[model samples]
Structures are given as C-alpha cells and as structure tokens.
Target: MKPQERSELIDALLDGAISEADFLRLEAELHVDEKARRDYYERLELTTLLEIQAEAEAADLEERIVPMPATGRRTAWFATAGIAAVILGAIALLSVVWAPDPAGGPLAAKIDSRLEPSATGFAVLTNQADAVWDSGGALTEGDLMPQGDLHLTSGVIQVEFFSGVTVILEGEADFTIHSPMEMSVRRGKLRARVPAPAKGFRIRTAEGELVDLGTEFGLDVTEQHSEVHVLDGEVEWSPKSEAMRRLAKGKAIRSGNGGGTVELSAQPGAFIDATGLEEKRAAVRASRRSAWLTHSRELRRDSRLLAYYPFDQPAHWNRTLTDESGSRLDGAIVAAQRSTDRFGFPAGALDFSPTGSRVRVNVPGEHRSLTFLCWVRIDSLDRWYNSLFLTDGHELGEPHWQIMDDGRLFFSVKKRDATKKQKDKQVFYSPAFWTPALSGRWLQIATTLDLDARKVTHYLNGKILSEEAIEDEYLVEIVRIGPASIGNWSDPSRDDPHFAVRNFNGSMDEFAIFGTALSATEIAELYENGKP
Candidate 1:
C-alpha cells in the first residue's frame, strides 16, 4: 500500500476495523517500509496529544450541568465469548426470493469501521424508514447506520459520516441514532455526530460542517456533563477549543488543550465484514435526515394477528401477505381490523401473504442478528402456536417466535440445551390485533435482539408490548415466515396455524429489521415515515 493508502488503512484500524489477517498483512508491510513506519509514528504522536487535550476538556465540561434523556429500554448486558453459535444456512429455498423494490428507502450508514459478528448490536436500517438496525460495524467514509431501538454491549463505537467526520460511543450506551445530518446525544457518551462535509455530503451537529474529501474516521467526543455522544467523521479532528477524544473504536481520544488523544487498550484484532458495506452507508444518509428530539408512542390495536405491511410500495409486496375477516378481538376491547372491508386502506398491508411454502426472510444468507416488526389485526383463536416467523428450529429453540395457544407471545431462542433455552418463559401480552375506529384497533409490532446484551425486547405501536423475556435464546438456522392461517402448525392432528380467516382484515405496514436493536427514537422515526 502507498503512503496515502497506509494512512487510510491506519484510520480504519484505529476505528476497530481490519481483521487479524489484514492487520498482520499491514504490519508486515510496515516492517520493510521505514517511511511508512515513520509516518505512522508521527500520526500516533498527534493522536496522543489529542487525548491529553480531551481529559482537560472533560473536566471543564463537568461545569455545564446537563440533563440526560431517558434510555427508555433497559438492556440485559451479556459478555461471554462462548461458541459463535452462528449457523450458516444454505441459500437453497431462499435463493430466488422475489425482487425487493429497487427504490427501497434511503439506507442509514454505520460509520463505526469495526463491527465484528460477535460484537453485538440490536439495531438496523432500510431507506428512510425501518424498525431498527446496527452500524453493521463498518465505518466507510459515507456509511449509514439503521435507526431505532439501539443498544450496545460493553465496547466502544466510532461512527463517521460521508463527509469525512466521526463520533465515538462508550460502554453500555443506548440511544436513538439518526444520521450525521442532525443528531443529539440523548444518552451515553458520544464523541460527536457532526462532521465536515466533502463533495455533496452535508453533516449536521451542534454546528454542522462542510469538510474536505481527504478525511479519516474516528473523531469521537462524548460529553459527561450532559451524557451526550458525538462522532466527527472525515475532516481533520482539530478541535476548536479542545474537548473529548477523537480517535477510533477501541482506542480513546480526547478533545481539549490542542485536542489530545491516546490508545486505551490493545485488544486482539476482530474480523470485519465488507459485504454489507452498501447497506451501512445508506444508514448514514438516513441517520443524517433523522430528527433529534422525536418521542415515540406505542401503537397497539386489539383485533387478530393479520398480516400488515406499512407501505404499498413494490418491495413490501414481496413478503408473505395473508389476511382475515369478520374477525373479533381475541383480547382487547375491539379488534385489530374492523370488518367493513377496507382492502387498500393501509395502502401496502400484506393482505395477500408474503409466502406460501416455507417460512423465514425470503432473502438468502445466514445473518447473525435480525429484527422483525409487524402490523397485525386479529379476531379468531385457533389451536397450537400461531406464529409470525418460524425456521427449521420450531418449538425447539431457534425454531419459533410466536403467539402461543395460551394467548401469549413466546419465543424459543435456543431449544438445544434446557439451560440455553431460558428456563423461564418471557411470556408477553398477546394483545389481539387492533382495528380502525373500533376499541381494539390495528397496531404495529416491533421486536429485536442483541447478542452481547443477551436480551430481547418487544414493542406494540411504539409502546413496549411484552414486559417479559422469551426464555429461548432464538438460535435458528432456517427462517420461517407466515401469517398463521385458519389452521397451520408443524404438529399434525394437534397444533396448527389458526385464525378467523385467510385474509386478515387490518393493514400491516413498515415491517423490517436491522443488525442491532431498535431504540425509542428510532421507533418514533418509523412512525413518522409510516404515519397517516
């Protein structure tokens, strides 16, 4: 790699990027290149200076007396590097999935350059609208991160924007991450979410910037005074008054007294994925456009578990679409879907059914984490576990996440070992779907998981629907998906997918997933996109 390339490579490495293999390759190259080594040492010195500046700044920031925003959800942090537990499912049945609309929403980007498979996150993104997503652990110059329900394990995160800027996240941090366009560190310690713009990209922060093209990642800053986090990407991180750290993911950098910086630890290099690079970039754009102070409200309608997709766009038309009618609310005051027959009311709900044969995301690939959000209206009761999604792992752990026969939402995450499967059930409310105008109206459902957090959360129309946890650790190979029809369960002569009718009465919309967990801010963002 040329000197310029070496510098770029160093920035990515500092941001927690570059696999062990790649790190070794770079290290060997440096041994023979004295100039490269010299240049690296010089940069390292500058970063050290920046860290010194940050400590002083943090002390000064203490005088401000800032009020922090509520994290909303509590994360059950888990940090054991046990078996990866990531099973690679062959792309056999899911190979030829229906084409997703080429015009899917603008994707959010993850500026964190270092997202490893085991580095748990519970958030994701899709275009301008989505449930939640992780940063995908990539810190591309223009990468985007998914918004909504975000939670991180005990680790640091450095996010950058398209215009050469960055923001760093500290441990156990949780917040609704919007793009670098407009951001606020409601919770956790963020270096900065603002960056200087380069080319066509424009960054928004305390005071947005227009940076130059030649920029590196990880210009992080977190305000303890207010528990706010900021990421300055691309542009050279020369703080105006010296404040917090502006280094990469693992290392620590500060902003103050000429902007000092330093390496906090020397953990082993973790592997990274370059495949989902595009999706990560899109997250940046989406986050850039998100509003900073949006509040999310739960949307719960009591009716039937009818399939509902938020938009009437083309891609959504690809998911399994099923419906029901003359249905009554199984639990709530009314029903999730009222009967008068409003076919296209929600515009793009899954009245038809996204699948017919097997269940699971029609897309190929064995993803480590996933988020499933749905809008449902139900009216009938049937035998067995009525499921929204199932995989080869059924009643067994990793096989099913469903509304059980007992009118409760249950998920069997890890069925292999009794210990793996939560000994206690995370029995949550199975509020029958809600309908329009009716007491039991239609509502939205959002669910997510973060491997590191060792926890899961369920939401109903912005509000947390399930107050409990699903004992099973949801470890599955195949992904099954469907709107429990009149009768269908894997168990023959016993449990079957049940409902009032095949075509659900209510509308479903804005159902998607992310690599990480969704946050309240993100949920509110989704509501805005899918709101009437």
Candidate 2:
C-alpha cells in the first residue's frame, strides 16, 4: 500500500472505524512487514502520548482556537494538507519521547542511578519494612542500587547482594553501602553470608571492622559494646588500635569500649538467612495449617456458627456456597474470577480485583456478638480502605472489617444509640497493627466483637494483633446489617456522595461467620485449620 493509504488505514484503526476486512488486511500486511509493524507501534505510542497531553491542555487549546474567516477556494484541500503535515511531525517526535538522552539531567531521566549503565545489580530487595528508600521507592528484585546509606528506624530488611552475599538487618540498623562487595553495619544486628567470591566483604561497627573470610556471621553493635558471632567458617575481628583476633566457627566474641572481651559459643539458629526468607515464612504457615487440620473436625462442631462459606464452587461463580451452618445463610461469589492456581487447595479461590468485585451474604437477623474469619492473600494495600468484610452501607451498628493503606488491620462498628439520645452515628475502630509485607502470601485473620464484654479483638496467624474495648455509647448490638459482603462494600443510598472505595484486589477463601464472639483458643483453632 502507498504511505498515504497506509496512514489512512492506521488512523481508521485508531479511531475504531476500520471495517473487519480492512482490519484483517492491515493485520496481514503488518504480520510480514517489519517496517509496517514499527510504523504502527510508533504511531500508537505517539497517539497515546498526544491524547494525554491534549486532555491536560484542553482548556488552553479551547482558549487558543479562534474561528477562522470563511475561505471558499480549495479550503478542504488546505485543511487536509495541514493535518498530513501534523501527522508527520508527530511521527518524528515519537523518537524523542520514546528514548531520551542519557545525560539529559534528572528531568529527562527514566531511572535514578549514578552508574554509567544507570543500574548496578548491587543487591536485591528481598523484603523490607519502614526502611528509608530513594525516590524510586520500595526496592524489588532486579532493581539497581547505587552506593548509598540504608537507614532502618524500627523494622527489618533482607537484602541479597549480587556477589552471593545475603544480609539481614534488624531494627535501628544504620548500614552504609560502599560497593556490592563492601558495606558497613554501624549499629543493630547484621547477619550476613559471604561466599567464596565475596570473601573480602567487611562490616565496620563501632568497635572495629569485621572482615568475612568466607563465612556466615552475625555482628551486633550497641552504644558501649559490640559482638561478633561466627556461625560458619571464620572471620577476622580487628579492633580500633588493637590486635586482630581470629574468630572461628561456633565461636562468639563480645567486646566493650572500656575492656576485655568475653568469648562464648555461637548460636547459628539466631541468624536468619536472607536468601531463604520467603521459604522460611512459607514453612511456618504450612506448619500452622498442619497443626490445625488435626482437630478441624472437632472445632467445626462449634454451636455458635452462623455461616460457613468454604468457597469451593467449581466452574460456575454465581452459586450458593456449601453452608455448613444449619442457618442456611448461603453466600455467593459475584463478579469474581476463580483463580487458576488453587494454591494447593482442591477448590480454587475467587480473585477480587479493584474493579468492584465481591462475595455477598445477606444474614437474616442481628446478633449481640459476632466473629468474622477468613484467609486472604492481599495483592496491595493501596486504597484508603480495602474491605475484608462489611455489612451493608455505613449504617449505624454495621461491622466493617478492612485494611488501611498503611498495612494496618482495622475493624469498626457504626453505633447509634437511642437510650443515650444520640442522633449521630459513632464509629468504633480497633487498634491498628503494623502488618508485614502481605503481598502474594496467604494469611489467616479473625476479628471478634463481644458486646457483653464490650471488646473487639483482631487476630493474625492465630495470635492477637490488636484489641479495643467498645465504649459505652458504641456498645450497641448489630441489628439486621443486611447486604453483607466480602472484598468490597457498596452504599445503598442513591444520594450518597462518597464513592465505593475499598474494592479488594486479592484472593479470599474459607470465610466463616460466627454468631458469638470466639475465644482466643477458638480463634487460634480457626486459624490453624483454615490457613492456606
């Protein structure tokens, strides 16, 4: 096809006006033509960029576009020629937008790195929490790291240096990165593994520099003292203005700023392996589930059961869940796709994307106390409120269990009391817990409301994360909080202005609702059996 004809076809395709025959013809031509494919992609990229720019500058464009005087002589031809010239100019501008100059300053920079390659495979961000990072934000695997200081205020981080050296830093650790081969742990616990090629790795603490002589070691530093524990192989501990001491495997040395050193046997188990961090976490979860399965049958006999949804529906999504509870409050999966990878269960889980997906359950009546339990694998905590379970709209005495954007688990109840002559709805929220990195991992969570005791409790991995006592005004019982749901909540009132925000983007399984508040032991049992 001619260049002008090809451009017309591309424009029609972009405008969604291309006929089926023309689309097939264009597809066939582009399939075998390298230049045509290149042209198409370039045009598509340029068009998308121009559209975004146009949206941003729409007001300015409207102000600038003044009506032109009527011209009769070849007006259509002139307009067509002008549009052709604009298209050519846009194609030319594509290269600059697609690939900018390397040394064009930070404004034109795509990645923030100091190296010539812009990224040195210095270390992999295995796991992190509350650690100060650069503008690039939460470092993941394969993210390049330039030489800089890593400050950990009150959370742990695991990093695997490219040289096969893995290091785990405890809280309050001040670590300076000199290169991939060298780093200084000024404070807190630094457990590292230096393999054959990375033997010269050194850690400079307050007292002295400990050089790894092909070893695995844990070094701790405090205000007045420092300790080095050699787990495997050996390390050379050199004190400031003092003689070097060769510490062998199974040995530990503690030295104070003022005096003599104390030597003892090293505990290898005390150190965590950064490379196997995720694996260890998975193993612990597996162990918990294994322990719970032993008594799952006995625990299922709890008399306070209101509803139990195993989410074992196959093929079809919009179906009633197997309600083990005799109350027959069957739940349903709505607008959720069944995950292909079952994550080890025979029945696959329902994945709820942030597109207003949910599982609904309309409990018939109210209860004095309530409990919600489920296993969730969170994809992100990006939204202000990501619902795990919610009962209807933001009405009084409705339970809303959700996770805040900061990875904190929250449980709230909207209470409106008539006895106290309170006209406004008062919300009671549970104490927040700093959740660890929860992406792509299954977690067992349970929340309980005891109206008699006027307390709310939250559990994770079978242990209590937070507990809050319900205030007197907020101790109202849950009364017919209909339109119960999981993964997302919707407002019932058409006049309500607030948009439904917390659409969960993750997988959920084994959702259970109890009529009475579960004790700590019962909560642990639920976690043990239901963990994936």
Candidate 3:
C-alpha cells in the first residue's frame, strides 16, 4: 500500500476499528512500499514505543494497591526480579533471531539474490527478438505452476507444465489458472498443452470459453476473435452461440466476430508482416504487449493531428505493455507526440450504452442502406483493417460478426442471395478459408450495403477498400441492422471473433455509421467538425 493508506490502517488499528489480521496485511505492505516501510520504522522508534512505555509506567502507579500475605510478600521481591530477568532474556533472544539477514545465509541468500516475485520470471516482448527475465521468475524446481500472472506483452509466451504439458500465451496476455480444469484468460491469447490424467483445462476469454482435452497445439486469441491451431493433441473450440467442433493437430477453427465456425489447416504464417500472422507461432517476451501499444499509438496519432478525436474518447483502455527496462503503459498512447500538428487521440472513449469504440449509430437486424465513417491515421493501409472494421457473415447458415485478429479495423458482410457469394467470391472472401488483409495508410474507412439492391462498398480514409456483392442467402436475411460499434470493427461474439484484448492500439476518432451509402465528400466530412 502507499504510505497514506498504510498510515490510515495503523490509525484504524490503534482506534480498535481494525482487527489483528488487518494489521498483519498492512505490515506486509510496509515490507514492500518503501515509504510505508520507513514511516513505520520511524513511528515505532520515535513515538509509539515511547508512548507505550509511559502508559505502562502509569499502570505501575497502582502497584501499591496490592496487599500481600506474609509468605507472598517475601516472595514478591524475588518474583519481580525473576520476571525482569525473563523479560531481558526474551528480548535478547529476539534480537539474535532478527539479526541474521537472509542475505547472509547459503541457499536462502542465493535464492534471495536470484528470484523476485514480479509478474513473470521471464519475458520476451514482440519488438525485441531477445529474451529477458529475472532468475526468480523461472521455475527451477518441479512443475512451476504460477499462482499468479505471467505477462506476455505481445506475441506469444510458452510454458512447460510439470506434467509435460505446455501452455502458450499470445500477445497482450494476462490470465489466472484456477487449476487444470479452470482458468480465465483475462486478456490476450493463450494455448494450453494438456497431458494424460487430465481433462485438459478450462480457458475463458473476454469473448467466450474453451475446454481442452489433452490438446498439444496453439491458440491465438485477441479481442476480436480466437484462432485455434492444433499442433499435436486433440482439442475442442466451443462457442456458446454455435456448436463445438473437435480439432486435431494441424487443423484449426475460428469461433469469433459474430459468425459460426470456419475450418482451416491452422497453417503457419501467411499474414505475418501485416498482423504478424506467422504460419507457425513463435515465442515473444511478456513485455511486448506494452511496446506495441506504445508504438502503435505514436504512429497513429501522428497521422490524425489530434485537433479532432478518433476512435472513441481517450479512455476504455486498460491492459498493459512493459518494456525490457520495466517501463509500463496501461492504454494505447503516443508519448511526447503532443505537438500541435497532431489532431486526434490514438484511442478514445464513447458515452453511449455498451460504450464501445469505433462507434456506429445504427439499429440491429437488417437494413437497406448503411454507412460507417471514422477518423484514422495510417502507418500502412496495406496492413489489414487499419481504421474501422465491421462485418456480417455466417457459418453453415447462421449470421455473425467477423473481426481482424490483430485487433485493427476491417470491413466485411454477408451476400443476401447467399449462393452467389458462396460461388463467385475470391477464396479469401469466399465461404472457404482465407482471410483478407485491408491495406493503405491514413485512409478513412466507410463501408455500406444496400440490402434491397444486393450491393456492398467500402471507403478508406476517404477512398474505397472494395465494393462488390458475393450474394448469399444469409445476406438477404439481414433486414435492419445494429449500431456501428466504436473502438472495434466487429464483435463476432455479439452477432460472432480474433484478438489480444477488448482495447485497440491505433487512434480512431469521430466515427459514425448511417443507413445510407455516403459519398466521398461525406466521408471526408467525418474528419471535419459536425459531418453527419
């Protein structure tokens, strides 16, 4: 605790409002927070100890009130002296006990010098290929089960469980394992290796849940969707809205971004450079997540010029990215990019229900005309889903939302005629496997579809990403639609899913989605003041 908090605890204890257990907790923090530690020592030495002595002496004034019998009176003097000797001996013993610091011991000293109970024993962030860690962070002994968090800033972190099972952490990772059967992926991505004699573990993400069955493989999870790549063992990717599919090594399934399951080989890198979507997953430092947020924000805000806002308000962000040097950031932000030249925030907040980002104001279901307009600054439009992302797709005939795995924004939709899209579409945009990468820099994205006309179109920064219709039965089914979700391109779980966390890294500002297709002038106006 901080010094102020610690002082309050002490005051509360002295006043009898707190119990002994409460005091012990505060005492533990005093050992951690330096200021609290020092203040406690000073108060004990200069004030409390002296004050208690005075009280004890005052209590001694009533000693004469005791009347002793003949034998008792004779014994009283000796008893008093004996008790005083006992007290002195006890004090001496305690002094000796407290004098031997752990730094002087053999094993105790060695361990103390090597290990520290920080977030993780080791880390490898995305920005650096080099690995870093504290000695205490690794499990030197048997199966080192972390009773706490092992931060994976960006990319992935792999752990070998005592049972010969392994677990891999995807970027922006934070999780707690309750046991082999239960765990929560507070954010980012994770892949667990389940050994025999175990039913595997239960993993939960911000999107949904997973129950593994002795699976040896990788799981890539972001705030947008979850991609499962089975390397060796068998596992099942289950979704609450859809049926569960059992997966074998080399096979993969996507159960996110509002659609149903799509099967693929779980192939190693294809979109590596763009989303770092490597075919084979690799290990990354736990601190890389922090670095990505830092850099991504800096790059984006420079593109926007901050006079206007992009994405949402400047909140709705909380996670972390720490550098090898231990510098940390809780939200996506640009440092010292505070020049007047910049016009928008890297990421912002909204003040509506659901309070989402990359916000679109619309009704859910089906609609005839739709438009999504948002402010954006781009590093590379060639990278997938730069500014805003939204999609309406389905698997095996159910409607869902689709999102880019990197947590950037992308655009997609269902073809109402359904059969046409299932046939004439590019494999990447087809019902079959193959995800697209939206490219360009600083382009505003505005996407829309006229359901009655069976058409689709996109506008980037202020240009077009694509405009076409694949035609599908599912597309025809969407009549009215939902509001444009801010901060995100799509929430697949909402309608369907990939991603690191619920928060995005790039800056997004002044977003809106309407029922009608907007012209290039209108799209550009979104970046200006009051352009509906």
Candidate 4:
C-alpha cells in the first residue's frame, strides 16, 4: 500500500470507522511492510500524547507540552513496546462504527488536526432536551467526540466511549471528554459500566479520580469534591490530596478538599442503573409542557385536579413522589424496585413484589366527583382481590379500586340498601370485563365516580369498559383521602399485616387523582400522550 493510502486507512481504523476491506488491506500491509508498522506505532504514540494532553486539560491542570520528533515521527514517552503488545492482544477492540452527525456537520472539524484520527467517544446513546455543548460541538449518536466540556443546563444523556465504557449523565451536570478511557465530571451524576477490557477506565472529579478496577460504578461531582460508589467488582479511589482507598463491591467513598471518607452502606444507591430512559424522558417533557404546568390559563385546565404522580424520580433506592398540582402533597416510597415501564426510560415506574413494598401518599379530602387514573402492569391473579388503589379504611364512603379474582376491574363506593329485611348494611359491586391473561404487561385504567349523576364508570385505555348506576341513597363516605396507599389494600389484618394484603406484583406508573371526572376527550389525550 502507498504511504498516503496506508495513512488514511490507519486514521480510519483509529477513529473506528474503517471499512472491512480497508481493515483487511491494512492488516496485510502491516504484516508485510516494515515502514507501515513503524508508521502505525508512531501514530499510536502520538494518539497517547494527545490523550494525555486532553486528560490534563479536562482536569484543569497545568498543560505539559512534548516536542515532536525532528523527523516528524512520534515516539512513546513511556514504553511503546508494552502498549503495542496490549494493542495487538486486544486487536478486536479496533472495530469502529460511525453515523452521520445529527446536527448535519463534520464531526471531526472541532478536533485537533494532528490527533483527529484518535478523537474520543464512540456514540451518543442519548441526547436529551436543552443540553448545551460548551467547547465540543453539539453531538449526536455515532459522532466522534471532540475533547472538551459538555454542559447540560437541562436534560440527561448517555454516552458510550470507544473503550466500552457507558456513562449515563444527569442534567444540571457538566462533563468533559478527556480520552476514550478517561473523562472528568465537573458537576453531575453519572452511572458508568466498564467491561473487562476497559478495566483501567478513569473518571476524574474536582478532588479525586476513580480508576475502574473492573467495575460498574457511579460518580457524583460538585464544586468541592467527588463521590464514588462501586456497584460491582472493585475500584481504586485516589483523592488528589488524600490517601488512596480501594472500594470493593457494594462499597462507596467520598473525597473532598476536607478529607476522604469511606461509607459503609451504599445508602444513597449511587450505583443504581437508570431503569427507564425513554419513559423518564417522556415524563419530563410532559411535566414541562403539560397543561397543568405550561398552559394554566387555557380552558384545558381542570381546577379540581388534586395530584399528579409521574414517578419520574432519579435512579435511587428511595424517592419522594412529587404532586405536580397546586397541592404539594409529596408521596414516599418504601422498598419499591425502580425500573423501566412501558415508556422505556429510567424511573418510569416502581415494581412491587408480594413483599410489603408500597407507596404511601397523603390523600386529598373526599370530593363529590372523583377520578383515579394510572398505568399498571399486573404480574398475577393469585389473590382474591388485588388492590390497585386504596384509602386507609374499609368503612362507609371510603373508595377503593381493585381487580377481582376472575380478572374483573372492580370499583366500589360505600352505601346502604335500606330494603334489606334485617336492617343489615348492603355493599354494591360493579365489575368490568375481564381481559384474558392480562398480567405482566402494562395497561391504562381509570375509575370515576360522578356523584351528582349517581354513576360509576371504569375506563380501559381511555374508552369506557363498564358503567353502573348508583342507588338512590348511595353516598361517598370518604371524609379523608389519605394516608392512602398504592399497590396493595390498606387492610392490616392479613397474615403479613405489615405489608398489607393482595399486594400488586408488577409495575405502576403515571398515577393521578382528580376532583372531577375527566372528559372523554381529555382522557383520550392523556392516553395518547402517555403511550410508550
């Protein structure tokens, strides 16, 4: 191969975008041509220097300059033979993938010309709203990363580095791409998954560096310090001004200008993965643009709306669910598993097992007209009554929604039937059609009680599934809405009284309560908007 052609192929290979035929040709040339091998080694050394420079700059350290060889050839500053051996042994890592930049521009233009071939980053797994690129240009998936700061004012992103490290970065965060194997988080929370070949991958923070000792970990950085949590394997935490510490699996450590501290428990769940990336993003967009937040003046507004729970919390063991209405009735989660819902993003929903896990919310006071809506995935029908929503009591006037043993949608409003001969209290039952094998998948449901009309209605996916008329004396006795619970009945008399009975065994997301029945049009819009 000619020198220019060989150089182009080498560049493409380093950048991870060379064609199969070109790669084969380059391999053959390197085996037969001594000069080609030398050129490749020189380029490798040059790439290393550029990587070190990028790392230094990203860490805000004083820049160190290395003079180029007089013959225009680059030699390794450390030992080249060892790097070459490792590179050859890990030849499979050379494969590259590239796609057109989303911003419709050349990805390499912003990179340094001399080290353009080894530009950092592999792909933009995610690019959420309002993320700003400070020095590196706006990036899309598959675009080569130019080493610089990525300042996200709002939104989250997942970036995959060429070294097989994946990082999910949260918004209000700032990050810098130092090299394929190194990065710096100035301010943000990031979850990183590093495979074996990328064992030495390092993340630098304001006060320390986390060297991946073959582990999946998370790093949160602030103006004063950095925190590290190892989810799996082990990691070496080296604080710039303190003694280095080794964090084993399930361990966490924090370092700042003050000193370094080791945490016994992964209490904050720093290493938890993002459960639902897409659903969480949708929830964010909806919350930001929903009529409740963005268009309060419009007629689409419903004043009776009490609470809206999107379940879009960060990736953590415990989260407080915020009520997005004028009422700031926050809910607390207890031992619930967070994961992707139908929407495919992290924190879209919480998973509850037969275990006592459930969410506790302060219920609003009872209203004449009430509506309850949520997205749920049932795991089974083992229990007689699988509760979905329930207030604290089973007394007259309190309302609850559940699924019957035969898979029927059940909703009840407390009332008395005076016609009973013995003066015995009478309770009514209204059940909707049973969806065959309706477990393990997501479904949208709404149950509404319109007191003035004396009617009870249930909706599946926005359309009415069943409706029933109320008795003449039927009255909703719910004086207080809460201390309400979700995913299980409020009955504290079961064998495992602590967890309640008939616990939901699947996921629930985007639950809401309103003081008025939602119009069919409004329900339809909600269903459409909430679709995954």
lDDT of 2 at 118: 29
Report residue 317 deviation for candidate 3 (angstroms): 12
Q: Model 2: per-residue lDDT, tens digit, 292-332? A: 54454454566777777666566653556666666777777
TM-score of candidate 4 to 2 decimals: 0.42
Clashes within 3 Å, all models in order: 176, 1, 100, 10
Writing each residue's lDDT as its tens digit, candidate 4 over 1-532 gives 7899899899899888999999999987886578999999999889877875454344344565444344422345223444666677577455532344556553353322323353434444443433455544555434455556767775667777878888887777887788778888889888888999999998888788889987788787877767787778889988887778888887877777677565654433553255644455667656644533233233224567787777767567557876766588888877678866664556668887737677788875767888889988777655667778877655556677777655677777645433445321223344534433344556788888887777778888788777778766555544246677887766565223323466777788878888887877777777766654
Clashing pairs in 4: 16-96, 275-346, 276-345, 276-346, 277-345, 277-346, 278-345, 279-345, 397-477, 397-478
lDDT of each: 0.38, 0.71, 0.45, 0.69
Model 1, poorest ten-residue lDDT window?
73-82
Of the candidates shown, which would achieve the greatest lDDT relative to the real structure? 2
Count backbone overlaps in model 2.
1
Off by more than 4 A, model 1: 1-347, 352-368, 381-384, 392-399, 404-407, 417-440, 467-507
lDDT of 1 by residue, 1-532 (tens): 8777789777666667888886887786776577878877887787775664443344346666333222431121111111222122224324544234365522211112112232222222211112122444422111235456456544444555433444445545565544434344333543333323433232222211223233322222234222111222233233334442233333323333333333343221221112233344345434532321121112223122222222333332243322221122111111222222122232333332222222223222333444656555433223245555444323332424555433455544543444543342233454533221121234456666544455566666676655344344443443323222211233222223232122222234444444446666666556554432
Query: Candidate 3: what lDDT?
Result: 0.45
**Candidate 4 ranges with C-alpha deviation above 4 Å:** 1-302, 416-436, 477-479, 494-500
Using lDDT as the yardstick, the better of models 3 and 4 is 4
- Checking candidate 2 for backbone clashes, the offending pairs are 397-414
Model 2 worst lDDT run, 10 consecutive residues:
110-119
